[model samples]
Target: MTYEDIRVEHRGGVSTIVLSRPPVNAVTPRLLMEVLSALDDLEERGETRCVVLAGSGTKAFCAGADLKADNTLAAGDSFRDLGRAVVDRLEAFPKPVISAMRGWCVGGGFAIGLACDVRLASTTTRIRTGDAYLGVIPSWGMSLTRLTHFVGRNRALDLLILGEDLDAEAALQMGLVTRVIPEEDYDAELARIAERVAGGAPITFKAIKETIRAQYMYTPAAAQALETHWSDIGGASADMREGIAAFREKRQPVFRGC
Candidate 1:
């Protein structure tokens, strides 16, 4: 499918969605709709094992939504609900989603990265929760505990409430970003990460995501029990047998996500 605001490129097991609107890549209704559609499409493609979310150009991942957009503001009360819904879907998507961020990751952009399972940034990356400056709260419910779980409560508050523009080093230290690569190596490093993730056992990755989600959905006791359930799923798969065989043969295992 074609998308005006973004472009999808599938290479082997990895499908990458790049926000294509340049000069800031500000989010708009079109971008939101297309992104959700892309996610839905990739979710149904069993051959796709992982997704890479990014933005075009070196200036920004997305500078947030276009404030003047008809659907964006109403006495600080509204913006169509589609954006939030898409973000929520991204958060709970069964497959792993990785965000490769550079330049400005502000407001909604920051939230988008938070939704991803893994975040990697270039040294030039500057992230801010730009909503506080607009006198509006994060529409995706900033209090959803994602940021807190990534960073501590106080640090999350510093970004959400204080609206500090965090540089790559600080973000990494806070655990908001998984890695910060040098600008010159960003492209190559991102590809390597994607290759590694896409080559992993699909069923194992799915189980890992579920176990993490279960951590938030269940009590500590319940989550512990849930761990066994996910493990059993992995243990029962054909891929598990293949993994053992490959290990004994000293060869790479080809997982079918079964």
Candidate 2:
């Protein structure tokens, strides 16, 4: 499908989805839909083992909702519904997803990052859930839930209630981002990490993601059951045997999603 709000690029096993709505890549229903479409396309492609999300230009990864745009904040429920869909889909995506953020990442924008499996920030990045200060709450999917899960209740409360922006270092400390890279190294580091993640065994990666999400969604025993299920799937996969063979041969394993 043709996408106007986002650009999808494939490099080796990794697919990078760049938010194309410029000047901040603020969220809109169209943009959100485009993102969902890109994800659908990537997930079906066996070559796309990893996905990276980034924004256009140098301004911001995303500046949250385009307050000035129609069918956005003014449209109310429609915006909320789409926001929820995009973030929820990201959180549960079958393939690994990474958010490469720079400059401003606020409210729904930051929520998107939180939903990803990993978040990478540049030194210039500043993230916050600014709705509280506006006399509103985060209505974008599971923002608060993910935030609290990453940063503890106290830190989550501090960010939400105060509507303060956390710099890259602070975000890393709070576990909001996997790593903070210098502005100059941001792109290179993100590419390196994406390549590394993309090269990993797909079945193992999917199993790990599924198990981690299961822990939060199910009872302890149920979660364990899901883990065991995935364990069986992974253990019986050809990739597992290939991994073992590679280990014996002292060579890098080539994973074929099967």
Candidate 3:
């Protein structure tokens, strides 16, 4: 499907979704809706093994929400619903999603990157979540949850409440991003990482992704829901069986994502 504000390209089992709004790829409601739709398509296709999300230009992965468009909406459930729809779909995407960030990643843009399974940023990237400065709380709760778990609560609070921008190195130190590369090598590095991820066993990747997310998002009590899930599903998975068989046979295991 054609998208007005984004570009979707598929190659080598990796689907790259580019935020295409110029200057700074701000997340307008329409753009977010399109992203949700695109993710749905990718998941349903099952052919896509991985996804990379990036912006159209070098200046910014995204600056934030389109304040001009957002301001036009009345303050009520409609606004909340819009934001939740976008974030919820992103959080629920079945496949591994990577965010390749460059330049300014702020507010909603930062939230989107945080939602991804992995984030890689150029050395020049500046990351910030500035909802507090706008006299509002962050609507994307899971990102903060992840941040707090990855970093300490104090540092997460400092970044959120102080609205401090972190450079790529600082972001890595804070566990907000996985890697930072030079701007000159950013595209090549992103491509290599995406290719590696796409070539991995799909079922194993999905299981690992789900396990990490479950651990990151749940408390001891809440984790109970997943206890039976892994046993029932993972114990019977083809990849698990192949892994054991391969170990005995002293051969590489082939997985079909069953």
Candidate 4:
């Protein structure tokens, strides 16, 4: 589908979906819709094994909702729902997904990155869940749960209630980002990481993602059971056999994503 608010680019087995609304790529209904649409397309593309989510330009990953937009306040509910959907979809995405973040990431934008399987931030990255300042909780896409899961209740509360800006280093300490790269190296590092994920066994990656997500909704025992179930599936895959053979041969295993 054609899109005005986003741009999709492909490199090898990875696809980068860029939030293209100029001037900080602020969240809007159209932008959210386009993101979901891009996910729909990528999910079905057999050649696209992984996705890298990013914002256009150097300014921001996303600046949360477009507060200054004419329809933002008028269509608050619509925007919130769309935001939730985008986050949920990203969290449950079958293939591995990475959030390549830089500049400002706030509220709904922060939620988006939290939903991704991994986040790689540039040195310039700044994150916040500043909904409290606006007299609202982060009602966009399970932000509270995701934040608490990542950083524990005390820290999540600190960030939410205080609404302090978190630099990339502080975010790394909080486990919000896997790593922070220098701005000059960020783009290449992001691509390298995306390529590595794309080269992994698809079924195993999907299973791993599903099992981890189960911990959020299921009891520990139930989650363990799910993990075992996925493990069994992975153990039976041809990729497993290929991996074993590759180990013996001391050669790289080429996974077909079965």
User: Tens digit of lDDT per residue, candidate 3, span 6-107?
Assistant: 999998789999999989998777787788889889998767889999999899999887777744254345555666676666666777899988999998
Top candidate, metric lDDT: 4
Q: Between 1 and 2, whose lDDT is larger? A: 2
* Candidate 4 worst ten-residue window by lDDT: 137-146
Between candidates 1 and 4, which one is better according to TM-score? 4
Q: After superposition, how far is residue 180 of candidate 1 from its true place, in Å?
A: 0.5
TM-score of each: 0.93, 0.97, 0.87, 0.96
The per-candidate count of clashes, in order, stands at 0, 0, 0, 0
Per-residue lDDT tens digits of candidate 4, residues 173-230? 9899999999999888888889998988898888888888888766778779988888
Cα TM-score of candidate 2: 0.97
Alpha carbon lDDT at 254, candidate 3: 67
Which residue pairs in model 3 clash with each other?
A: none
- The Cα error of candidate 4 at residue 6, in Å, is 0.4
**Positional deviation of residue 140's Cα in model 1 after best superposition, in angstroms:** 0.5
lDDT of each residue in 1-258, candidate 1, tens digit only: 878999999998899999998888888877888999999999999878889999998889888887776755542333447667767777778888999888999887888877788999999999888576787666675434567776777887777777778899998998888999999999999989998899888877777776677776567677677678878888899999999999999999898888
Q: What do the candidate models score in CA lDDT, each in turn?
A: 0.83, 0.86, 0.80, 0.88
Residue-level lDDT of model 2, residues 106-213, one tens digit each, is 888888988899999899999988796777668775556766766778988888887887899998888888888899988889999999999899888878887788
| Candidate 3, RMSD to the unseen true structure | 2.7
Clashing pairs in 4: none
- Pairwise TM-score winner, candidates 1 and 3: 1
Report residue 34 deviation for candidate 1 (angstroms): 1.0
